[model samples]
Target: MELLIKGGTVVTASGSFEADVAVDGGKIAAIGKNLPVTANQVVDASGRLVLPGALDAHTHMAMPFGGTVSADSYLSGTRAAVCGGVTTIFDYPVQHKGETILGLVNSKKEILERDACCDYAFHCCITDLNGGEILDEMAQAVEEGITSFKCFLVYKKEGMMVDDGTLTRLLLRARELGALINVHAENPDLIDLRTEMYLKEGKTSAWYHYMSRPEFVEAEADKRVVHWASHLETPVYLVHMADKEGLEACIRAKEEGHTVYVETCPQYLEFTCDVYKRPDGRNFVCSPPMKGKESQDALWTALKSGFIDTVATDHCPFQSYEKDWGKDDFTKIPNGCAGVENLYPYMLDAANSGKISFERVVEVCATNVAKIFGCDNKGAIAVGKDADIVIYDKDKDFTISVKNMHSDYDHTIWEGKKLHGYPVQTYLRGKLVYDNGNFVGKPGMGQYVKRSHK
Candidate 1:
């Protein structure tokens, strides 16, 4: 496999430069200006940006949720991901009751080995965490390359919530093992109390979903989780931070000398609580629900200023039909939105329009995530790195809709939004996988990437 990407501006986390990149044997062979070498294939990236492929660190493909399975299976989800210029994805696989993290890892890896279209990994979600047996399994999971663990503070009814004491122990264990921890920070008890109060008073609409999990609900949990991690001196990554108050929780943690990484999604940056008033607002229902417009502006500002560490799609795709389950009651709706297919195009579109710099786009979507999650060989465009590349036509425009996207989900909250950039071609490990709206990669074409702790 020999390929050359020529006449493009190579965007990296720190900067951009005009260069020609060479690939051989699924790794970057050389990168230089006017490389005087030949290859079996040449991508004329003239007037386009050849970017390091985006790494979506949050996705839940084929996972069961809310009494039903998420719509997109591994094949469809990963195809959508690569079509959107993402060359890698790290999804969380939940540990069932009585299941060890290593057991869950093996099960998920088997499925991914047969369906994933891009290189993949898992963050062991410790849902049934228990005694020394579980801790021992966690160490084995780390050695097997599942280095990050996630625990939710919400979803108590689903048995997914981790108690404060257990979470503290997990944080300390992670710190001792040289692994990172991710948390879904939301106060479930307050959510339950709020939802019951509102529904009893006839507040059955989608708006109550926002009312139930108010920004302060997440903000308080975010602050408390930081305290837990700080007390244990463990590095923590807060997933799907949606509000200004939550951002401050992270900022305060950093100020007080704790290692904390923050991620906010496009849904939070692009939409707000107003969507709940729309007829189809239930489609936007997710935990840590989108906040008011003020918070939206703050997230964008934080992303640009580097205060926010990364952007991810929490890509737990549920169909429109499945989403309607919560129409009569907000609590019944499946929580999540589909945006893995939107990450690169949206971020690139924003970069083209000056909402963010190209470097920042690379930082949030690719490089920073790799650094945070220990994916050393996966992020940047350089020698010996995996040849995961995206040829983006920065000037080409497209409006987002499910008709053109590859995710199996039926609705996109970002529908009808115009974007002036899209991926024309994508290469995973020197192989032409997606080309101009077609998925050329086969199921199981993707390889499992073991994330080593650095």
Candidate 2:
């Protein structure tokens, strides 16, 4: 059915303006002050904001990790995503040892086909760069519609961290293949040393998770990766960066014209290491653990100043039982938090409270993500683009709680936080998928998007 979303400020990365948008055949058919078009549905966006649905460039759904799978399956995760105003999500499906890129990609495709509820794509995670055959795999991965490879500078103990030599080779290969690489940067050696020292002192609480991985650990590793990217002249995206010095390095590179994209999560921006001190502090455990108040302040500043390009959730939630595994040892804790359901309203809350401009919200959470990840038909309310849109009610306020969220997970990190503005209605491909607090998305309704080469 055609949809006419009228009388709202259409927000884009560039700015916002009052306009009427018409949708037909799942694409934005027209946009004007008064779109002289008839439609099966007319959405009264009066007194509201019309936004391009958020395109979360980072997500992990039903991903296997730390002896357990993430709590949300593809269906549940994407349902939460659309309800939160995310119409497109690019998930990370790591290629395990002895697994071919095609094998892993196709396996993930089967699951997404059966369960994903929003438009989806993937970043081919490389855990084994075996015998240089992995270099050729990078090119094949791009042809397979996977244009980005996820690499880790940490996780050495998990046998996931690609050595610097392997990372360099991967960078060189990705550059040649016109693909991009995203790295989880944290110096394992330094982190390991610190963790050992803290343990020796009998510091076993969740707080030690933060102490063991100092800010310098991330900054030094970031610098190393940035240097490698510069040498290879390949673009690299640093995921979930949380340190002031790390932000400085990324900013300096951008000022120098390096193609370094930085991403930070809502958890790091809002919470500090102090959360780890709570009785249930272990629940907040994640890799590149949250830092102090100073680092949180710096991360927020970096985002506002444009050094950080995206605010993704890294939504790899684990239940309380899983968190308990790490209670005896911080390293055993599953490294993730439930966030796909909160990305939209949380950012809206940030904008409403003057932490960021409304335009900045569309930029960081939607537009830039599409551009960076090559989501061609997403990120803006414009002609010929996918009609993935959200009608946000600025006058509404809702308290977030696990009871109302759609994720299959049993807990929430933003529980009880009230969002001043919320998405009253959401549409994916010009179809009503969510309204008020109810979800209407269907399993297998989401299509895998083929991204263009960088």
Models 1 onward score TM values of 0.98, 0.98
lDDT of candidate 1 at residue 144, scale 0 to 100: 87
Best-performing candidate as measured by lDDT: 1
Looking at model 1, which ten-residue stretch has the lowest summed lDDT? 127-136
Clashing residue pairs in candidate 2 are: none
For candidate 2, give the lDDT.
Answer: 0.88
1-454: candidate 2 lDDT, tens digit per residue:
3889889999888888999999999999999898788889898899899999998888999989999999999889999999999989989988767888888889889988998889999998898966667777778779877899989988889888888888888888888888888999999999889989988888888888888887888889989988888767789999989888888888888888999999998889888989999878888888888888889999888878888899999999999889898887787788889888798788888998999888898999998988888888888998999999999988898998999999888888788888898998889999889999899878888899888886
Q: What are the per-residue Cα lDDT tens digits for candidate 1 across 130-247?
A: 6567777778888888899999998998899999988888888888889988999999999999999999998888999999998899989999988878877889999999989889
The positional error of residue 297 in candidate 1, measured at the CA in angstroms, is: 1.6
Q: Could you report the Cα RMSD, in angstroms, for every candidate shown?
A: 1.0, 1.2
lDDT of each: 0.89, 0.88
